[model samples]
Target: MSGQTMYEKIWRSHEIVDLGDGFSLLHVDRHMLHDGSGPVLARLKERGRSVSQPDLCFATLDHVVSTAPGRPVTSDNRRRTIASLRDGVAEAGIRFFDIGRTGQGIVHVIGPELGISLPGTVVVCADSHTCTHGGMGAMGFGIGSTEAEHVLATQTIVQAKLRTMRVTFVGNAGDGVTAKDLILAAVGQLGSAGGNGYAVEYAGRAIQTLEVEARLTLCNLSIELGAKVGMVAPDEKTFDYLAGRQFSPKNELWNRALASWRDLPSDHDAIFDAEIEVDISHLKPKITWGTSPAHVMDIDGIVPDPSSTGHRNAVQYMDVVPGRPLVGLKVDWVFIGSCTNSRISDLRIAANIVGGRKVADHVSAWIVPGSENVKRQAESEGLDRIFKESGFEWREPGCSLCLAANGEAVPPGARAVSTSNRNFVGRQGPGARTHLASPAVAAASAIRGVISDFRTMKD
Candidate 1:
């Protein structure tokens, strides 16, 4: 018998019908909508169509809401967007977790936390970071506004299947080297587009050891590697994370669901279209030095020379000498949140680093939780107090300062060491020099007022 991969198994099981020429009418088990999905819902409304399966839809406010404490809807446009989302969800009879509510937060973060994204299922969101749900072993990916409307009209989407790629990480990462650093290293080695057009599965000892939150962090950046779908096989850890959650199955249903999920991993001899192996035995904490995620280096290493086509421009734009080490480079700001890193575990890591320390008087720092749940969880454990005491702004949950979409931005010409993904020009603000790092690094740098190695800080 031929061995089937996890991706193939999920695809075959969820495929309603084959449409030929590599297209299939795929069943979407969970349809997640956010502010960006507002326009699509409006379009569906204009067409006099109602959501075919509103029970499968879940909506939240994330992309454009202010993450400031008290969960303020700062602008009239944002308020209007919120109103449209509420109306659309009400008309469709779908669940809406608005700001300041129990389930509200980044759509990606809250989905898995609430068990809406489960193993052996298909998850779709309008945002590019929708793949973040793949950490729960679901076949999750992003779609466009048009696709959003299609899903809303009918609980299925027409899509071409992607080729499969298996990336294995062998050897243990050193202390302070996290999922963030490992993915950054993979991006550095494979280049940004290496996983293009493939459904990439991360495996091996290192991946197997990551907690569910860390696994989510790794899968969250899969799109940064140019793949829309990135997944990890669900195991005991996945089941543990989902057990007893608000939306998770209860009692007998839980056991039945677990039985089904246990069978979803790929067979031993499953074949993949492409395979890549990476060794993290000697890996160090990494940070992005240029505009692209691929333009990265070790936190303690020297910047790369601008010999590549885009490296010259990236270096010039970043205002850094190529051969200088990233350590000790003065920074003006630090941001430690986003869909990528803002979970309770991420908060603890940063809090541990800055517990009794204060942020550098020269640097401005902020810590925005990924969701309201995360904020409450952190506050319960006094993590917010640690951050605020350390001179970091302990803000409410939203995608704050990550994209500057809510008017929360890094100063122009200021350099920021951030825990968020992406270091693209003006991603945080016009002319902002953004350097991507892990939460620990961001916290330590905020204290030191420079790009720094968090592991070297004295306890």
Candidate 2:
């Protein structure tokens, strides 16, 4: 057999039919649902069809659900949306994880935490961050609600294969430099549309050394690069991370699964349509100075001159002057949660930075976990105490303030540093100037009341 890249291997494995025009009828091994699934399930019900393979489907309540502890969902419409999801998934016999229930969390975070996303598997979700599961070496991507309905009805999705690219992070990452920084730097170099039409696989020294949670952060931003799918090849680390998770194979089956997963890496001779390399030996923690992620600037660096129309608009909207440093700029809020960086590992990173330090009195900070399990785990480790004692609000699990669609938002015209993936205008709230950084940087900024790099802090 010829050399095969992991994408080629996973793609061919799930292909049910070779459709012309570069598309294929792909059998989906896992389909994850969230409150956004309500409309799709309704469409399926309208067709008088139950899910084809409910056993492979999972649902969770995350988006649209309030993250306020012990407080009921404030919006009647949101409550109704949750109820509809529960009713539909129950009727279809798909596993459902409601608020306050086991496995209830952000769809992307819960999948791997529950072991439903495994190496070499094909995973899809109605949510775009489904590419986050690519950190586990799965062939994962997102679909629209209509496509979601089709997957529910037939357990398959018709997809066009993509050209592939390899983005290698060369050299070592210094202290306080994170996957978030690495990706931000990459986007800064490649621009928002760099990976258009390609499935990008991250590799090399830095990627290989990163923990799985960090890898998830790296892949979570793949969509920002205009790629539908981003992947990392499975290795011993991936296998170990999934070894005993709730839905992982057991006993002899575990061995069999690992053996297969071991073979999922791209061969040395495998060819990619494009290649890009980034060196991070001297890379610093990065933050977005403008709306697009590609507008990243070093945490200690000055705002760049408006070089394009978009840059001019970003500078105007953010109300930041060109050629001025962002460090020590006042910020009104700090958020540390999202599919991109809300895992327990991320929380620990923030906690270590926030311990024995108080959030700047001028800044409001929130620490939201990605899942119920992640919250529980953080509490068990006393990470919650570190955050709360440091004046950060310990929020329940949900995608709060990330998209600001659930009544949680930064105030208009306020400057905020967030750990969420995007910094689009009004992403946090109308006129909110969002600077995207990592959990460590967000935590450090929370204490300093400015966009400060974590590495420069004194003990």
Candidate 3:
């Protein structure tokens, strides 16, 4: 018999009961909640079920919460939502990372950073990018509000078994090519719905060489790729990143956890339902030209024909001339924050490029850290000052500008080079034209006031 894939291994361990017909009742090891998750807590209570394991759950504020410095939790709806989760968790004895707390930040960012995400465990959240935890080898996926209530009420969820696909990154990435670019290239090759119903595992030398944060960025976009879950088999790098984190196993527990993590990778003889190889040996930084992530293009490439059925609407909405390139296309905004790319390392990459260079006069640019911890660390390293000197706003952390949910929006008809995961119509704001790219590319675009190539900008 062939060996089991990592997803299969984790799924088998978590199966509490086999419901037959490809479905199982799976134990949930960790639960993460955000501001929008208040409804789930209310629903769980409404059903007269108490939180089954409050100690295993955590709550924080992210979506729809303002990212402004000293931002007030105003508005009846926002205040009520925040209060509901805060009060519910407090009542249930769950951990709450409230505002001004060290662990507070975006849900996906805080999960891995705090070590709530671990290999060989099942982590679920109401946010689609909860798959970000899979960077550490966990079986992570998003759940709907109903599913969230079910997990909280019983510490288990009913789920369908997913077919596994292995995406192998062949050869090394070229300079200026980031994990963001690599995934964008894959989306371009495989199309948006390529991985529908499949649990995708990223492998090969390129994935093996990426650090944990880059892996998080890679898995964060799995939902956009139409995959329910995405993961990298844990290795020494995963153990190294998790060690000493707030909730990570410690001392003797740490040693045992490390031993188990070493066993999480797929065996050499493992078989996948499908296999794909993305040749990134000569890849360049990429940007999204249309609404979907699959509508990607090279830094020096021309736009697709607007006359094409797939592109006509996006092209007309973005107001771009078909056959023309995006370089030197004036940008009105540059956002360098998102669960996708707002970690400390991502900030360093952007600060390195923006240092000693001023943002264009017409470009409104901002840099938001992923969490309070990341914000503090960046300030300690003076990255905030570097950004400020370069005319970039060093703002508080949240899901800012990425979804435009926290009272932030890119003006209608304005062009933005963003580091967020999605470039869908209205994803940023009403009629906002978003070009999704990496932190390096966003920094370069802020300076050039257009969709310029970071490779062309010398430090």
TM-score of 1: 0.98
Q: In the order shown, what is each candidate's alpha-carbon RMSD? A: 1.0, 1.0, 1.0
Looking at candidate 2, what is the lDDT of residue 124?
98
Q: What TM-score would candidate 2 get against the native? A: 0.98
C-alpha RMSD of candidate 1? 1.0
Tell me the TM-score of each prediction against the true structure.
0.98, 0.98, 0.98
On a 0 to 100 scale, what is the lDDT of residue 211 in model 3? 90
- Candidate 3 residue 142 Cα shift, in angstroms, is 0.7
lDDT of each: 0.91, 0.91, 0.91
Distance from true location, Cα of 283 in model 2, Å: 0.6
In model 2, residue pairs whose N, Cα or C atoms come closer than 3 Å (at least 3 residues apart or on different chains), thus clashing, are none
lDDT of 1 by residue, 1-459 (tens): 779999999999999999999999999999999987777888998999879999899999887888776767788988888788888888779999988899999888999999999998999998878888889999999999999999999999998999999989989899999999988888888888998998989999999999999999999999889989999999999999999999999999999999999999999999999999888999999999999999999999999888787999999889988889989999999999999999999999999999999899999999999998999999999988999988989887888898998878998999999988889999999999999999988999999998999889985
Off by over 4 Å in 1: none
